[model samples]
Target: MSGDRKEVVKLLAEFSTIGMSVAFSIFIGVGIGYFLDHKVFAGRTSPWLTLIFLGFGVAAAFKNLYLMSRRKDL
Candidate 1:
């Protein structure tokens, strides 16, 4: 029973952080994209970098989620 409870707790912790990790990854990507677009690039390319990086962020999030879900122990 204790072992089962520990497994459950581990699952709960993993699930709880999933959304946050994805969100944080996305936000960090966007922040970098935004900085490059507006400050580094001087808004010359405008939204292109932002959009590209945003897509990358989404892809990374999904990839991370997939890896997390594939964990055997969890």
Candidate 2:
């Protein structure tokens, strides 16, 4: 019983972190894109790089969701 309870609690903790992980992934992606566009390119790329990076971030978030859903333990 103790082992089972421990497993449940561990799984609960992992699940709880999913939202934060997803958000962080997106934020990091956007931050990189923003840095490249504004600092590296000096506003020449402007919104394009930002938009491209935002899409990448969104794709990464969805990928994280898919992987989590496919977890065998879940």
Candidate 3:
């Protein structure tokens, strides 16, 4: 019983991180794009890089979701 409870708790903890992981992934992507566009290109690229990176971020988030859903433990 104790072992089962422990496993449940561990799994719950892992599941709870999904949201944070997704958000952080997106934020990091946007941050990188913003840095590149503004700092590296000096406003020449403007919103294009930001939008492109945002799409990448969203794709990454979905990929994370897909992987999580496919977890055997779940």
Tens-place lDDT digits, model 2, residues 7-36: 999899988988998999899889989999
TM-score of model 3 vs. true structure: 0.90
lDDT of each residue in 1-74, candidate 1, tens digit only:
69889889878987998889899889978888999999999999879999888888888899999998788864
- What's the residue-level lDDT of 62 in candidate 3? 88
Question: What RMSD, rounded to one decimal, does every model reach?
Answer: 1.7, 1.3, 1.3
Worst 10 residues of 1 by lDDT: 65-74
Tens-digit lDDT track of model 3 for 1-74: 69999999998998899999899989988998999899999999999998899889988998999999999876
Q: In candidate 2, which residue pairs clash?
A: none
From the highest lDDT down, the ranking of the candidates is 3, 2, 1
5, model 1: CA deviation in Å? Answer: 1.1
* Model 3: lDDT to the true structure: 0.92
- What candidate 3 gets wrong by more than 4 Å, as runs, is none
Best by lDDT: 3
Model 3: lowest-lDDT 10 consecutive positions:
65-74
